[model samples]
Target chain A: MDEETAKMIADKGAWLCLQPFLDDEDAIPFPEGTPQRTKQLAMVAGTENAYRLAKKHNIKTAFGTDVLFDAELAAKQGKQLAKLQRWYTPFEVLKMATFNNAQLLKFCGPRDPYPGELGVIKEGALADMILVDGNPLQNLDLIIDPTKNFVLIMKDGKIYKNTIQFK
Target chain B: MLFLYGLLGRAQETAEKNTILIINATVFDGQNEKMQEGMSILVEGNKIAKIAKTINIPQTAQVVNAQGKVLMPGLIDAHAHPMFAGISQQAGLTSQDGYLNLVAAKTAEKFLMQGFTSLREASGNSISLKCAIDQGLYLGPRIYPTGPMISQTSGHADYRPSTSIPYDPNATLSYIERSGHALIADGVPEIIKGVRSVLRMGATQVKLGAGGGVASIYDPLDVTQYTFEELKAAVDVAETWNTYVMVHAYTPKAIQTSLGPG
Candidate 1:
């Protein structure tokens, strides 16, 4: 259906199932070398190409994280890929996974001088928060490591995985 | 054999008489380094055939200088947004079709001048433009392009609200090509089929917007648009055809939602 129809469906409070890129007829083919390779190196590499698509389409995107399934899985594969490639930083990778995404989602609140109370450790408002052993504000991977930096409990939320502590 | 010799002789006569022995120039051979300074590099037939510390040069071999300039393999950006002479800035308003070919032509050249020997244009409906550059019809960098991005309605790529005025309804379709971007499909089957169509048209990589855009009117940016199964289905189809998917998202929810099981 055209965009108007889709919007109409959405306006009525219906969920719209979305598709991915590469599915567009307008997508340009990958260049000449390795033309035969099936794997999408650009996506896995998290190259600027993926970022450009996100920019142009105004869509939120990560290197290959969006296409990958699990957060931990994305981190694992992303790390492995970066390691084999030998030129990626884990911090940058984590940033792409967290804050960059937060920016796209407009989640962390406004751009004002620290909505200081927004993501702060307060009680009444968003009791739902994550408490990690190691500082995730510095390294994103720590958020995932149950051993390195275990997650406590969801203050006022449902927990999918059990909470654990290190020390 | 005679034809080959004749070709070589003709080449030898017209070619510059510079038998340059690049001694110890650092060469980044993609994988590793073979750094040996004293080795002499021979230049014959436009190719480096041998490297010896001491070698007898043909009387016609002209020795030149290579004091500096490390010979590391050229770097690759893998991605870029090239701009041209007049169309560098994409902010202002202009006739859409008027400069279509021109922008395509110049952007390709800009990519080359910037030393990006090969590049991947993330998204655009410019396949023919890419073909023109590929066939040497124009001067530009080698480009692998994804013609356009696929997004859902009122989704990250939906440009309706932004393009619309407080009083204009017809403005809807006007911005479809620009903001709604290209093929915005629904559900798993349609998504799969859409990807196949792009593949048929020469797409080397697939791109998708799995959540609301950074600037959406209805839902929050982090609001998930496609379910994990949906994205996985798209990825599966792409993989079957020898391609992969790239999703557009910013929020952790969007990222975590769109990408699954790695």
Candidate 2:
């Protein structure tokens, strides 16, 4: 997207949802030089530009891994977020994937089923949190493998996995 | 010193009656650059009641000593397709609905274990899966379902066998059409009906295919699909239902013409 278009998006209060996809993670297998393969590569190429434009234009951006129809590739969801570190700090990627993305879900408006605060860790916000085995901001790659790094997963104040050792 | 327990297993018993106190972790809080070190959080029922360095909780509360790990908001995928993300393109087109659902069900759990707490489904039929997760029959991320993507005939989502093209619109629904993966609609009336049909099936929003795409069998990357009236009709139906439309478009003509800067 051009700077003018990016500015229009911000002025209109629209969001640009982006995914960090590389060639290996293509949702479908596309052999080299095929029209589909070329198109797929071109789409991924636009991701970086859109992200940078959104930041430059102060547009609200959302993060997602649009890895579909490939369970093996889908497992690498966290890597998509971690790769964003190429364009942003770990903290920035973390925030965009969390609290910032939740803000966009609110656009569902009256159709929103899970009403109440989401995405933030604050008083009165929904208790959706994770306990990482290491500091994500310091080492974002730890997220690339959530099963090992996310020792605990809690949703709506309910603990689903708790493997932390006690003192 | 604080101690916690684990392995309540896959079935969530319900919101913990006892408050959960998580101590000794660095908190990200989802809105800051600087992480708060050595902090704690108290979850009462389903809300974070407090976050501090010291919290005096009742003896019965669940105390999780984080051991200085990172405590942050669960991840969210603003765009996802839980129902279609796992199976292969061929499997999605030919697999039985029942089998496909089971695969998607497993996919949902995998995504959750990956630390995604919420997902805004960009397309596909996940209404029943969302209901199942909500009822505690299974575990998965919160899904904001958008239902099947609507497309114009030979547009982005059209994946019918080549011989089947130009078939009578009045004929029995195609197997793929019956599968609810996508709908082939044309003109303003069909567009409105398509949008309303998905909404009837509990879609929170509607997705319209506004241009060509590579993954599908037909159309080049730059061809714009739906006309302005058909696209507007879809938007009108969604707006009347208090929702919105997300078009799958790739070019300026496809996007700007339909979804104006207004």
Candidate 3:
């Protein structure tokens, strides 16, 4: 993004739904000079600059991973979030994924399908939460291995996973 | 894996008590930067009833000791394609008999297990899959579906080969179209219809292929799609239904052109 675009985003109060997609283990390599490979490189080359400009202009940013046609890439969702630590603090990264992303969802207004508070651990909010084995803010990389780190996952107050053993 | 599945299954059975008290948790409430240590939370039904340093645990509540672990709101993905995320390109176009959706279901399950509670669909036919997840028949994130991305012929979303050319209106829809993957729409009337069609399918918003896309082979990355009238028609239709349109664009001209309409 250029300064002008970043300024426009800030001026319009628009949310920059940004993703930290990189050429990592998640991506399947395309042969050189193919349309897919050229496009992928062009798409990725702008990401870092976009983030810096968005932050410099204080644009409202949301985190996402636009994974498609790749199951292996889909599994790296947490790693993508962790990748944000390069540009933001661990707390800021979590906040972007949780709070900021939900703000964009809430922007849907009456069209919101699951109408209720989301992406917050507060009284009267929808009971969507994750119980991590370790403090995520201190050790954000733990999220990359969710099977062992995310001990419990809850949505709508339902326990979808509870790996914790109680005596 | 079997033993863990057994535990998870048992947890589900007991989790229906509608009230749960999580004690001794390190709280990182989404809005706050500071983390609270040794906090507790009480959930009643599908909402958080209380969160404080201490809570009087009801005898009926299912108490879980957090063991001072961190608790935070589940993650949300602003742009995702749950219906297409886990499948290969070949499988996306060739796999028959609902095989793609089964893989999508697995992807959704993994999404939740990895702590993503909600997903906003960027483009895909996700309504039925979302319904199944909502009905508790499958495990996945809460989804807001867009049905399909509207596109013009030779635009970003076109999936037709040269073999199926000459633009025969009476011809049968392509497999991708019939399966609700993409809508090849052009002109004002078709744009309006496409927007309304997705809304009728319960799309939270309409998505438009307003420019060329990387995955779209036919159009170049610099090409801007949808004339002013057509883009305006889509926006007008979406507004009539009290919704909006989201476009996929990558270039200055493409972005500026769509911005002109919306």
Return the top candidate by DockQ.
3
Give the B-chain TM-score of model 2.
0.89
Lowest lDDT block of 10, candidate 3 chain A: A21-30
Candidate 3 global Cα RMSD: 3.8
DockQ values per model = 0.02, 0.71, 0.72
Per-residue lDDT of model 3, residues B1-262, tens digit only: 9999999988886666688999999999988989888988999999999999899988778888998689999999988988778887767767762887888899999899899999989877888889999999999999988888898998877877767789787999888888887899988888888888888888998889977777777888778899989999998888888877878876656666666666
TM-score of each: 0.48, 0.92, 0.93
Number of backbone-clashing residue pairs for each candidate, in the order shown: 35, 1, 0
Error (Å) of candidate 2 at residue A22 is 2.6
Model 3: lDDT equals 0.85
Q: What TM-score against the true chain A does chain A of each candidate get?
A: 0.36, 0.92, 0.95
Q: Which portions of model 1 miss their true places by more than 4 Å?
A: A1-167, B1-24, B30-65, B82-94, B160-181, B212-220
- Assign candidate 1 its CAPRI class: incorrect
Docking class of 2: medium
Model 2, A1-167: lDDT tens digits are 56776777787787777777666544468778888888887766766787788788888889988777788877878987898988889989999999899998887789888887788899889999999999898899999999899999998887878888543
Report the C-alpha displacement of residue B259, candidate 2, in angstroms. Answer: 2.7
Compared with the true structure, all predictions reach lDDT values of: 0.41, 0.82, 0.85
Compared with the true structure, what per-residue lDDT tens digits does model 2 show for residues B1-262?
Answer: 1222344521243333448889898898888978888887998888898987898975657888987689999999988989878988878888888888898889989988899989998877788889999888888998999878898778877877887867876777777778787889999998889999999988888888887776877878778888888888888898999888877766656756555712
Candidate 2 wrong stretches, greater than 4 Å: A25-27, B1-18
